[model samples]
Target: MDDQTDSPDDYHAICLGTAARARGIATRYVDGVYSRFHPFPSRWLALAAGGREYLFASGMLLLKGSDPWRGLGLHINEEATLLIRDKQRAKDFLDARGFGTPAGRVFRRGDLSAALDAFSSFAGPVCVKPNQGTKGELVFPAIADRARYESAVRRVAARHQKILVEESVSGQLIRFFFVRPRVVAVKLSRPASVVGDGSATIANLIEAKNALRDRRAVPGHSNIVVDEDLRDFLAMTGRSLDDVPAAAERVFLRGTSNGATGADSLGCRADLHPSYLDVLAAACNAVPGLNLTAVDVMIRDPAAPARHGNYWILEMNRNPGLTPYHFPWRGEAQDVSGAILDAMERGFAPVPASPPASVPASTHSMPAN
Candidate 1:
């Protein structure tokens, strides 16, 4: 056997298994890469959790839990989430069901002319990403010009056959985790940024920030990278790596608000409006059997009440991970896995109390060009 087990995927699995054990649920790490787990064998991997047998695969725990989604009749299985892996198809499905998303077009590989043409008339800032993407990989947020949009397309198209070019939605990347018809937890994610200490250059400041992040043994935290994206972002602001900003000034490093990309998260379940719950439930109902999922929403004004038609449902993540939610950077940890276990065992889990407030700033502005 190999002596090393440092893969992030394994780390995530261990975290999930640990969370399950805390809820008196046994877990076994299945060693298959496929999304579905039934065809292999019943004996290869099995667990008796909360007095129920479950099949585990690719960091997802499955069981014959009661249909917690009211009359939706969703079973706990990976098969129900396959459609969402294809982002464009998922958008089409949700759009057909009346869920509002940013309007944009999809481009195939080697179709630069068509993609640039679409970008020419694109209303405003755009977002470019792969049709089949995960963990915000190769996703360029807030693409404003044709050059950047084309560069983003090339980067994403190198790996994926098709790319999605959508209008950029402004606001906080707020996420709502639903365990079937109920919002279990809410998180506010912001792009990674560093506050200038006034003395250190941007390059040195980034180094210091990354050094601090690297010392931590957390699951989701990654060092803020110094790459072309960061360079371009800084250049747009008439700054460079060697420039030093005044103290208390904040400089954003990335456009995407994914924890894997060094973004900060705050637990904000208490601040969500009651109306947001209705919208979240509606998103779940859009896809039959999508009981347990996470809805990524872009709220223009997060401080205001989340009224219907005031937010955009970015996408519904099929198999949402619990590590980031459990070990947030600056907020009380959420027992998401525990809630799942409770829901499976008793058909319901009491919503956790709102943690201490750690709301992010009300707004984020683009770097001045």
Candidate 2:
């Protein structure tokens, strides 16, 4: 795993496998193959065979022994998973509960006119994305006019029946990897960018950067793509591939900060404000049976104390990719997989006669969905 030779899915599996081995739990990939297409395995399975048999798939765990295992793994039920998948519904739920989430609306493909109307009502630029999208695909951000809004909606509608139009928040994207009762890791996502040299053209800098990425072969890091989108993004800034930027100037290559789309993932757990941690814990606890999740947030400054309007909860992920935390390009790697397994093992332990007094009261309650 340290060599970073495996894909994100393989890395996650390897991390779990390694942790399981240390716990004397036997494990193996069900198909003996790793999926290159998904952050998690589509078919990979981990089986712990000893006095008890445990099966793990895409963060779900099944225990088999004298007692039958419940369908939920890490206390994450199907209902909660489905709720989080529906971006609009999840945001509505959080908003109604006084959680800090962006105001947004959803429209079906046939309701393009309604979406446009809603976009106009927004005071600032809005983002158009699929209601059930992931990995930032089909997500168009920072649209300030009707033309871009309509085009973005139509483009998203081509792939999804429903689109989510929300006011775009200006900030850095941060991911908080939460396992019951705590955030195990935090990552800052930055779009693919290059610091300019005194004389090199933007095109040459991009080429060199891609070459470096190839040489380093950092798992889950994608090569900066040179495409129409990149060209358009540069054009918006009155520059082109041929332009030479002054030395030390950094030029971003993409607007979407997604790992699959050439974003740089940096582990920043140590730099996260304690207030944000409190907010994250409270947010995760608000959703019933949401034991393991990745909460994406937009914050102007992570070091600043979290306030009502300073940060917005983007969405929660049921199965977040662990590769970013394990192999961040700029900071210390975190053991998110290990924390997940720790939670699983804790689930199997016998309940104590009395709950620990030091444990916070919030941790004991699960809000009804």
Tens-digit lDDT string for candidate 1 (5-64) = 223454445555576667666555334322243333122123465466654433354553
Report, for every candidate in turn, its global Cα lDDT versus the true structure. Answer: 0.67, 0.73
Query: Which TM-score value belongs to model 1?
Result: 0.80
What are the models' TM-scores?
0.80, 0.83
Residue 275 displacement (Å), model 2: 1.2
Task: Please identify model 1 stretches exceeding 4 Å from their true place.
Answer: 1-9, 33-46, 62-79, 96-98, 346-369
Off by over 4 Å in 2: 1-9, 31-42, 49-77, 348-369
Report the C-alpha lDDT of model 2 over 204-248, residue by residue, as the tens digit.
999898899898887779898888877876865578999999999
Residue 323 in model 2: lDDT: 72
Please give the RMSD of candidate 1 to the true structure.
9.0
Candidate 1: count the clashes. 0
